[model samples]
Target: MSFDEDNSPFGAGVPSDVYQTSIREPVSLEVPEDVNPEAVQPNTSIENESPVNTPPNGPPLADWSSGISIIEAGKSTEGASRGYIAYTIKLGENTVRRRYSEFESLRSILSQIFPLLLIPPIPGKSFNLKLLATPPPNGVDTETKLVEQRKKMLQLFLKECLKMEQVRDTQVFHRFLDPNSNFNEDLRTGEITDLPLNPLCSNPFNGLDTYKNILYSYLPPEVHTTSMDLESLHLQQEDNTKQTSLYEYISLYTHIISSADLSFSHDFDKANKKVSTTARKLTDYYTQCGNSFNSFSLSEPGTELSLLLERIGTSYDQVYLIEEGFIEFIEKRFNDYWKFYLQCFGTIRDVLAFRELKGRQCEYIRSSLASKETAWQAFQKSDDESQRLTQAIRKSEGVASKHRLLLEPSLDVRFVPITVPNPPSKKKGAFSYSLSAFSKLKSTIADVITLQPELSREEQTAQLQTQINVLRQCLILAESDISKMDEFINEQFHLYHDEKLVFMRGLLREYCRHLVEVNEKCAEVWLETKAEIEGLGL
Candidate 1:
């Protein structure tokens, strides 16, 4: 269950050389300088220290355990309608109701005393203005849910404090749990006592092999299994989808950039030159045919043939523009993957920190339990007299009662962690989809070109006539791809429904408009060519 440093999701830090190299050359996709790896990296020097089994044989564990509850359930008497988690804590025999402000005062004092300990996060006041305005359906009000969640979180915090040997045994900690005492007055007058300077207790996390080992020990078997499954799935998805797509995109971009200034092969250049000459010859022949024609039908085919040649010439010449578009895509699209990679890396760092903190807490709990048993046994032996022995037994009974209310042997709290949500993904930034579309387009064009031989005829004029018809069909089929533009956009991007719809419609409209112009010109040429050919009876 232990996770080694190599298993860290953030990977290694970008070398110092990368920054220097990027200044002189093209920038790479390595981790950005802003995400300083050292900031969140676990202190490796402290990872070898063992847990503290005995806490310097401290004074008898203080009777600080208490039964905590929420008092003044409804709205406050003050201006606010939503109520706070006003606590009613019973420390020893005294029970008193106190507000959140008092709990904060206790927390502040505890923090100063236990400087090395991972002081649990306190739940903030949970209130919503909207819930106050209108009641929610099915009696599941937002504000009520918020209050309950906060109460549970706060209860867990106090329980964790009691589980710490250093915290629970201290006079300050006892005053903190005591309901009758004014914690603020105690804080001003009471002195803070540090834990005994034992090697293990002084810096608990100073040497640990794996942060995950402690979490796995405390977590339920099912939760541990589920977490492992999720992690495996995450790694698989990242490798198969995110990283693979990024690699492909980078390769494609590099290929495009390297070949941008490269000329077409000599054969293709020669072929293009011949095609241009042939197109000019066709235009000249059409003009000559027009001059000899006596009827409109004969003249019309010649004019149409001339127009088709011009259209073919125009489409072929736009290859440079297409290449430029590819370059522009690379410049903008890489940013999406760059941002996502950072997010993924950051999540891993957070997981590491959380696991380490939980491990320390678990160690504290183990030490506290041992101390509690020892203190209880020592008291029993020291009070051999009937009067003192009877009082010790009574105090022991109270300790057992408070301990039962807090500790959950069946449910370890260390693994019950919280998480932050992922950031929104950009629509145009889906590089995989973009690359797929490019691949499809290239395949389609190649397939269409192969069909040219099927239209071959013995006579040069007949072959030219068939080639024109086939090219016209290709233009129409390609134009129809624009109709599916919206569907393509929807498939490619992770956008909100309304936003996806809007973007799809807008992009499709613009694309269709461009295609319509191309299609219209092709149609005009085809119609004229057909008319003239029919009139010539060829």
Candidate 2:
């Protein structure tokens, strides 16, 4: 329960007892069509383990239990009912029987064994997720890639089918949370509509053409993709299916990860300990490794990574279904797909980087091959193909042509300036006045949050919290404005008042915008104070 430096679960792990590599096939349990919805609420659902035998709480689970290696494949077992707030070491297909936090912790943990996942699975070891990134052999045709892609689809599809039938997940209620988002059906429809009223954009209509231009330019390319021949996209075609749209896929991933059942029964007040505080309590298991008892992020964006994976998973059809808002829950709950859209961002980045490296390596190889007179004709063809592939990769990965160098062979976290929409609508120039208003409001709420000796326990405490909330929401509106402005901007704007947090301004602006607009009184005050919004640098 202590959250000090040492006790902090900086890294998490499964139970130490979960290290068993072999399993006896136990009875199977059938998944029901209607899972108990109440249990689906956050923190209210019952917790279960992977039918492992615990040795009388011998010790808590370590963040990384070195003694155990998950078996390559697991012996299927069914009919298990035990309650624990932790994970079971999964022996079955790593795809199935997810170790509770698999989608989140798995990436980081498995990455340690990366470049290895691209290699074939070890005979007796579990399937490492590397083959996906493994490069194809030399001289392989696109047809071959198509065939391989189809094969993968079939296997994954079948796996998904079996999972639906056999793996009955313990209905864990992720406590309900209230969303700050507002999905106005009308505003979503209009031409030249307004950004939701938030602090940064207290009045996006506030005459800041610079911010407006950013919004105009930032419109998602998908919106304008109507010209592409949908019929030509043969999902069944080998190469067609093999070729993926990283942007669409990852954005969908982000939304799902960001969503929590808004209906989760949240305990906003810290004192409500009696309302069945029985879920996600596994921090106790990973204590030895300086981990916490639970696996929750317990910070802003209070969501679990598993919940995100549950949305638009790698399963081919399901991914599209979620992205296209085919799932009623996802569509209704998430409204806008921005959250899901972001998930694949990192993946898109990686794929682009990969192609760049391949490009450089092939270039050097071809140059050497030609000079040595080793299959010079074939080398020239390959070098051309490599160059084309690099172009395709760059284009697909969402990086502009001029910044192609960012995808170079060696990947480093470089600080590059990205342009954002100008806040005001219909304008193409920067407006210091508009942005300055945002900073003014941010200062206001910040002053509220700072401890005041005179009113440390002020009766207006709730009112201040509400004020802060409004400011945050406005910031969000401003950000959305920026994103939508993408299609309208020719370049990325580098806005850094602090020199640092340049990338963070979008986030802060969103928060501040949200906080300002949520409260009528606060908005009124902001209107009065920032009405002039001039003579000072924005």
Candidate 3:
């Protein structure tokens, strides 16, 4: 899970060039050199062009320096009598207010539009449904804390989205940040709506126009098997000597991340709870010690001992303040970081699942093509056999007719009388009479109703041929799609691992910094307390 240089999960011995060569050129985000930047409006749709709103001269880019942030959160006063929490988001100069549900909608829309990409996860509405339903006595305080937590997490979500080049350049991402834009309306009449219901069966790059591509239309509706099943099937194909297929690579990566997630969850959860509990207890203990010292000082007023007691009380109060601040820091940094990390894992899993589905779609099309081709071959054989039988029968009939004509011309015919045969007597059985009536009724119904003629061999063969053609075309498209998807996923896989490394480094650095700062501050407080005791000559 740790992607340190020496212990990289991706083969450390493998040359970087191998990965670089395997990857296809990424979808360019630059505007074409031939296109006039000035003429390009904000909403213009151009291939290979960045969708982010930018000045005419500059390439469209996300400004991470003045990154997206949730600046504030408060109870909504607009629209309804029942107020809900709304978060005020700030992206550079632009500011917009959105509710949690709106954020959820934005994520959903982004995911649909870029189904192959890893969209960042947002905070859930409620962590504990029971707790939410039954608010504590200090419900206002709890609500405030929840709002603060969401503000932090939502800001992280936005930042994570911006970090992704594809996600950052989307108009949807920009609109979510725009103050005047109606995101809900945009979603209603957006590219997401135009995309196929099953994105796996469509072209990921140009999903809205997938209908125009007949090949994509012929793709199977959905993958019948789960991603895990696909992974298991490909597990045996993996070997150290050869480069694994993209699907196999994704499967391996997914399993690794899952294992890492489980380990991290167990260890981090235990550590976080331990630290939180310790901080709280220390704070309580300091409060009690401070109270005792203060009481002793009050009892020994007007003496040096009283002043010393008050100094000790003040030191305990300082420690109490430090511990309280530490608790808040732990909650914001450690707890929230773990939650966000888990969400990242979830997002990665989703992206991998999408890749698996695409692989399955390709497999389905290929199998279908094979089956169709086999059927077409069978139809051809049957048609050929029928044609030979038809020709032989016609030839025999012609020969017989010629012989009969020759014989008639050569010989005079003689007439002969034959004895007539009597008909058999009918049995008067009730069963026989009923069977006869049923048979006559069946005959009458058959004469009244006309059955559709079965397709002739030629017709059946032609139909099979048509299907074969379609499946072949579908297989071609599916193979092409899978190839492109693999390239994309391969690139994304490297990018994700690189990002993970950076994120992990940052997390470790932040943790160290927080601990160092807290320890240093606590040491200074104790040193001051020691100095005060020395000044009293105790």
Best by lDDT: 3
Global Cα lDDT for candidate 1: 0.40
List the lowest-lDDT window of 10 residues for candidate 2.
Answer: 170-179
Q: In candidate 3, residue 250 scores what lDDT?
A: 68
- C-alpha lDDT of all candidate models, in order: 0.40, 0.28, 0.65
Compare candidates 1 and 3 on lDDT and give the better one.
3
Ranked candidates (TM-score, high to low): 3, 1, 2
Query: What are the TM-scores, per candidate, against the unseen true structure?
Result: 0.24, 0.16, 0.76
In candidate 3, which residue pairs get closer than 3 Å at backbone N, Cα or C atoms, i.e. clash?
none
Clashes of each: 8, 99, 0
For model 2, residues 249-340, the per-residue Cα lDDT tens digits are 33443343233222122321122222113111222221322222122222213444433322212222222222233223222222222222
For model 2, state the Cα shift of residue 295 in Å.
42
Instruction: Candidate 1: list runs displaced more than 4 Å.
Output: 1-85, 91-93, 125-140, 192-538
